[model samples]
Target: MSIFKKIKGTFQLLKTIDLDQLAKLNEKIDLSDAIKNLGELDERQLKGLMKMLTTKAKKGQHQLPPIDGDFYNLDLKLSKEDRDIQLQVRNFMEDEVKPLVNDHWNRAKFPFQIIEKFAKLNIAGIAYEGYGCANKSFLLEGIIAQELARVDVSISTFFGVHSGLAMGSIYLCGSEEQKQEWLPAMQRLEKIGAFGLTEPNVGSAVAGGMETTCKRIDGNWILNGQKKWIGNATFADVIIIWARDEDSNQVKGFLVRKENPGFKAEKMEDKMALRIVQNAIITLTNCSVPESDRLQNANSFKDTAKVLQMTRAGVAWQAVGCARGAYEAALKYTKKREQFGRPIASFQLIQNHLVEMVSNLTAMQTLCFRLSELQDQKLLTDEHASLAKVFCSMRTRDVVGRAREVMGGNGILLEYDVARFVADAEAIYSYEGTKEINSLIVGRAITGYSAFVN
Candidate 1:
């Protein structure tokens, strides 16, 4: 080939690296002087240089088509109305959330601005009647979770804490007065909420090992103890704090308002994943709440279990979204990324990686779809949600690993978007319950052997 075509091919490969890489490359060799040196070369030397630059041994370049997820067309399963809802969320995530995700994640800050825009969707507290909530299906709720998690898991975490954990706690356990007071504003995003069940010493054992104490005093409940890993507690309007009743020794829930003088919430920092979520350590030093604020129907730990059961399905769907985001980003990158004189997607080995990712993503989506069906049918149980959570979270870890592997070095950078998923997957794997806990729940149910305490 002539020098013009040879240089063009060389530059095409060089385009793969950005300005920072170019600056680093300049430290070893000056690009301007090198280009000038090319003109001085003899014909034989130029041909040899061209061979070295383009590696003439490689075959011709070929453009590969773009890769996408949802190979099975799972979206078709939804009704027209639900499909429209999915598109509405997808468009919102792409437009309002996508551009700001990386920046907020990098700064470890939440974009408070999005709350007003998000409230307009009126999706909070779904599946509950009245309270200004949508009262939609769990399937649609799962789809929304997937959409939020696709762009940013931290936002999904925030939403889950508010919509699923906090609001669901009240919906399932609070009285009509409690629901009427909080749900409407919460659904509209005028009031933010947080769920405080996980404590520093009480994580997987939140059901039975809760250390926070609530005591009745002069017609008021005085709460004391600490809660760890409480999402949105730092700025939430209300935090549903779970405490053991000193007199009864049973776990009870309380609607702890944010402004209580005895309540202290310190922001937990230096997180490696889901940095945008403002998790906090909450200390209730004799925090006083009126008797009316106590969850009227949450008489025992069993009530907490009810709220968890209702929300665990959403966690499974969030894992699916996390995996899908990574898969889609990696797939797109591999297709456009030129390697060996052609797109990497053309390579048989690369195709294997891409196929595995989409396969797992599709399988997880289908599983959650059925899981939601069971939930809507009122046939869902602890074991059912536990199974889905274990499978999806574990599979998501695998999918994100493959995604990172396919992107090579670019996979780890936040700018490329796959790294966040890889990190956020850790949080998802441990959210609601860890893989071990969820598996145990399913194991005991199937085998008729209790293993939680032992």
Candidate 2:
């Protein structure tokens, strides 16, 4: 009689549920497990399950909007195809990259596993024409940079080296044969690439302090010196090494292969930030390359500056992504974290922090969008790029700092995500162009005085 009464109750509960309710429950739990164990449940257990399922259904129906950093709805401005690509990359980061990031970051290891899968996205050399590239708008390229950095700045820095510095060097300065040999493979991510411009002794003054010398003899160039902080150098298939011509006293670029006997790359250790990026110190001990491998069109520092002008904009976009990621994570944390029996997000001070973060993030996004537009129109200058890099990196530092502040002690934890952004922002702030260097570049343009050492 008792068993019969419980079965009747189960049947009555079933009548109140429909496929929609069951589908929602599937998202919250493994329904198949529930079904397999249903027969073993006592009357009390059956009643408890019914109540839990009903509560989940109510919560499902009231699902909140997804947390996004785009407070200004900038995504709506993208074309349908562009918007689709953005979402695809976002989903890949959220699903594939996000899960592996903290683990890899904690161990200070690069997740080489993602490279093949990331290649399938087909975004490398996206703005350049030919060479298996999409030849999309520069704006799309900036958007891709933003999307990648939002998840992990190390990943962003890795891609920037391969896609922007390495591939862009060949596209802008490589001979017809050089481009044919390298660009297609590089674009497919079949052959990873690195750029070696910053040497141990020459960071801010790489143009004039270039100690790496290349001497031409027997129609082969011999490279002799070292490069520091070269991203992706440890495992790259090729590296674009910039050196000074011994006789001409002019800066030149070389396509140095990893298989060369004299080329060696040692991984940099104990980095405080961007630990997942494989930065290396490269040594060229009489590294020899065929004359054909030289970047034929790279006659002077002016040509190399062309590549920097373009990639500097990408770095600005990356800063915005870093800020956005921190802002979104902090916002989500505050909303769910409770104090005094209510969410901290409802507190007045927490709201103020959130508001400040979003404002800076939105401003940075709009600035970069316009910078990309100028780049696409061929109206961008070195100063334009420098200004954006300066402003965005500075603003990003503020945004990430506040994000850490709002989270309190948990802000520094690696599991929380915001902590990584806070640390990585420091790297972005200094690289490409430091605040002092980039600001002087902009100031020189506006004031018509050369503040830089010549």
Candidate 3:
């Protein structure tokens, strides 16, 4: 072949070749001086070299579509009205709560100033029928929980304790007159509520082990005992205190108002997690609650479980939110933070971490969707709630850990948002039901064996 023809064929082949690979090939071939000389080439030649480098860089670039944790697009399935409500809550959290969370968490104080803004959402007693509730689907309730926890788990816990645990006690076990007395005002958030179930000695085992006692005397029941870890109890207008009836030996719930004598709720201090929740160590010595205020239908522990069963699903959704918050924060950090003149996200190993984190997050979102569906359908058993709680909470810990891992030192900083999730996830893992407790619940259901307390 002629020399000119041979050179023309070589240039044509090089033009078609992947420039990134060619750049690497050029590097290995010790073309440093030639590459340097090319930099001094004329504008047109320099432009051509720059174009080739850009093409090569683009080829070497990892194509990561925007990471959306909602793999199933469950929001699309919601009705327009429901979707609006969801966005309303989401906006409220993202705008109002997100900015204040780190400060409140660090100070270990509830952002009481936001309560008025929160009341405007009108979501208290959501999904409950009648008595001024929005009567939305249980799905909306789960979505609300997710939105709240996504920004601040402490706020979500406070909401759940009031709306789900306190009001739920009245809704599920209160008589018509009793419900008429409190549900409406509480629904409007004019009167905040708190649930007092966990005593210092009695945790989830309070079903039968409530050391707090109630004795019927004179037209009223006198409650005497200490209730610990009562969220919102410090400022709640009415706290639902569960106690054992001394005579019948059955547990009963009472609507103990804050003004009542002998009822004291001192804020539990120095909490390592969910600090903004305002959990109280309550003491009731001769706290007199009128018979009318007693949750009339709460004859025993079984009645209490009815409330827990409904709220347990919400807790699982909270776990999903906590995981998602951490995951997104970490994913963004990885893309922005650079090492060795490139984004850490450009590293294959970092990407592998992100993929795994998303995998777990997507699994959690999908699982919670079904969980809320089962709840809406009235088919959510203890085992179903337990399964989601176990899986989501456990997986949330993993997700948060990966988030922290990706952030390196910043992961441990409270201002980064991920550290709070990592700390809060620990509390959530134990509360509602510990990993072991929830696992045993599911285990018993599958194996037909009661493994608790034995």
Best by TM-score: 2
What are the per-residue Cα lDDT tens digits for candidate 3 across 329-437? 8988998899999899889999899889889988998888988998889888999999999999999999999999999999999888999999999989988888898
C-alpha TM-score for every candidate: 0.86, 0.87, 0.85
Model 2 superposed RMSD (Cα):
9.4
After aligning candidate 3 to the native by TM-score, how far in Å is the CA of 346 from where it should be? 1.6
lDDT agreement with native, every candidate:
0.89, 0.90, 0.86
Candidate 2 stretches greater than 4 Å from native:
1-66
In candidate 1, which residue pairs clash?
Answer: none
- Which candidate model has the greater lDDT, 2 or 3? 2
Total clashes for model 2: 0
